[model samples]
Target: MARRLCGEGLGTMLLLAAIVGSGIMAERLAGGNDALALLGNTLPTGAMLAVLILIFAPVSGAHFNPAVSLCLALRGDFPWRLLIPYTAVQIAGAIAGAWIAHLMFELPVLQLSVTARTGSGQWIAEAVATFGLVLTILGASARRPDAVPFLVGLYIAAAYWFTASTSFANPAVTVARMLSDTFAGIRPIDAPAFIAAQLLGALAGLAASRLLFSPDAKPVAG
Candidate 1:
C-alpha cells in the first residue's frame, strides 16, 4: 500500500510538471498562435506518462489520473480504500508541479492566463475525448497489463490530435490547471462542466470495457 501511494504521488507530480513546463515552453516558442505550442505541450506529456507508468506500474499500478483510478476500481482492480488518498496526492502533486512551473517562468509569464475553451461543440468534444482515453487505457493496460505504458502513451498522443478538448481527461489535472495562469490552465467557472462530462465519459468507457473485455479473463497481478 505504501509503495502504491508513493508511486501515485510521484507519477502525479511528474504528470503535472510535464503539463505545465511543456505548456510554458510551448507558449514562449509558439509566439501568438498555439498550434506548435500545443504539440510541444502534449508530446512531452505523453512521453513522460509512458515513462512513469513503466517505472511505477508494479508499485502503484500507475494510476496518475484520479479518473483512471476510479475506473479501475469499478473494474475491480484497485482497492477502494486507496481511492481518496490516491486522488488527494494526485491533486497535490499537480498543484505543486504547477507552482514549480510558475516559479520557473518567473511569475510574469506565468501570470498570463492561458486557459482554453471551446464553444458548445466542445462539450461533446470533451465527452468523446475522455471516452476514448478511458477506453484505450482499459483496453490496452488494465485488461492487458503488459502493454500499459506504450499503449497508453500512444493513445494520449492520438487523443490529443483527434479530440477538440485536447483530451484533458483527469479531474485532478483540470483542477490543478486552474491554479496556473499559463497556457495549461482551465477557467475555474468552466471546470465543473468539463469534469462532469469527463466522469460521464469514463462511465461510458467502463461499460464499453465490460462489454469488450471479458470479466473472466485472467487478472494481471500487480
Candidate 2:
C-alpha cells in the first residue's frame, strides 16, 4: 500500500510539473507566441506521462487524475478506501508542482490571470476533450494495457489539437493550472464549470467504454 501511494504521488507530481513548468516557460520566458515553444511544452508532457505510466502502472495503476481513480472505483477496479487519499495526494502534488514551476520561472503565478476557455462553447469543448481522454484510457487499459501509455499520449496530443479547450482533462490539473498566471492557468471562477463538464464527460466515457470494450477482453502483451 505504501509503495502504491508513493507511486501515485510521484506520478501526479511529474504530471503537474510537466504541465505547469511548460506553461510557465511558454508564456513567461518565451513570450507566449512561439509555436515551437508550445511544441516544446507538449513534447515533454507526452514523454513524462509515458514514462510515469511505464514506471508506476504496476504499483498504483498510474491514476494520476482523481477523475480517473473515481471512474475506476465506480467500475469496481479500485477499492473505496483508495478514493480519498489518492485524490488528496494528487491535489497536493499538483499544487507543489505548480509552486515549483513558479519558483523555476521566478514569477508570481497567483497574481496572473488564468488562461482558459469560457462560455457555453468552451464548456462544450471541455466536455469533448475530457470525454476523449477518459474514453481512450478506459479502452486502452481494459483491452490493451501494453498500449496504454502510447494511446494516452496520442489521445491527449490529438485532443490538444482538435479540441478548443486544449484538453485540460484532469480536474487536479485544471485546479493547479489555475494557480499559474501563465498560458496554462484557468481563472478560478471558470474552474467549477470546467470541472463539472469534465466529470460528466468522464461518466459519458465510462458508458461508452462499456459499450465498446468488455472487461473480459484480453490485453495484448508488449
Candidate 3:
C-alpha cells in the first residue's frame, strides 16, 4: 500500500512537472504565438503521460488524476477505503510538482493564476473532455489492457486540440495549474467549476461504459 501511494505521488508529481514546465518553456519560445505554445505544451505532456503511466502502472495503476481514481473506485476497480489517502497524496504531489516547476524556472514558488477560464462553453468542453477520457480509460482497459498508456496519451493529445477548455480533465491538475499562473494555469476562481464538470463527466463516462461494454449485452441480429 505504501509502495502504491509512492508510485501515485511520484507519477503525478512528474506529470505536473512536465505539464507546467513545458508550458513555461513553450510560452517563452512561442513569442506570442498561442498555437505554437500549445503545440509545445501538448507534445511534452502527452509524451510524459504515456511514459509515466508505463513506469508506475505496475506499482500503482498509474492513476495520476483524482477524477480517474474516483471513477475507478465507483466502478469497483479501486479500493474505496484508500480513496481519501490516494486523493490527498495526489493533491499534495501535484502542488509540489507545480512548485518544483516554478523553482526550476526561477519563478515565484507560490502563485494564484490570473488567467480566467470560465463560461458555459468552457464548462461544457471540460465535461466532454473528462467524459471522453474516462471512457477511453475504461474501454481500453477492458479491451486492450496493454494499450492503455498509449491510448490515454493519444486521447489527451487529441483532446487538447478539440476541447475549448484544453481538456483539464483531472481535478489535481486543475488545482495545481491554478497555482502556477503560467500558460497552463487556470484562475483560482475557475478551478471549482472545472473540477465539478470533470467529476460529472467521469461519472457519466463510467455509466456509459458500463452500458456499452456490458458483457450481458447481446449482439444485434442483422
Task: Estimate every model's Cα lDDT from 0 to 1.
Answer: 0.81, 0.81, 0.94
Model 3 lDDT tens row, 166-205: 9989999999999999999999999999999999999999
Q: Compared with the true structure, what per-residue lDDT tens digits does model 2 show for residues 1-222?
A: 788888888788888888778866665556556665666677778778888888889889998888899889999999999999999888888877887877777877455445656998778888888888889898887767899998887777667667777788888888888777776778888988999999998889888988778756565679
Model 3: CA > 4 A from native: 217-222
lDDT of 1 at 156: 81
Most accurate candidate by lDDT = 3
Deviation from truth (RMSD, Å), model 2: 3.0
Displacement of residue 61 (Cα, Å) in model 3 is 0.8
Error of 2 at 221 (Å): 20
Query: What lDDT does candidate 2 reach at residue 68?
Result: 90
Q: Tell me, by TM-score, which candidate is best.
A: 3
TM per model? 0.90, 0.90, 0.97
- Give the Å shift of residue 28 in candidate 2: 4.9
For candidate 2, what is the lDDT? 0.81
lDDT of 1 by residue, 157-220 (tens): 7778788778788888887887788888877777788888888888898889887776676765
Comparing 1 with 3 on lDDT, the higher-scoring candidate is 3
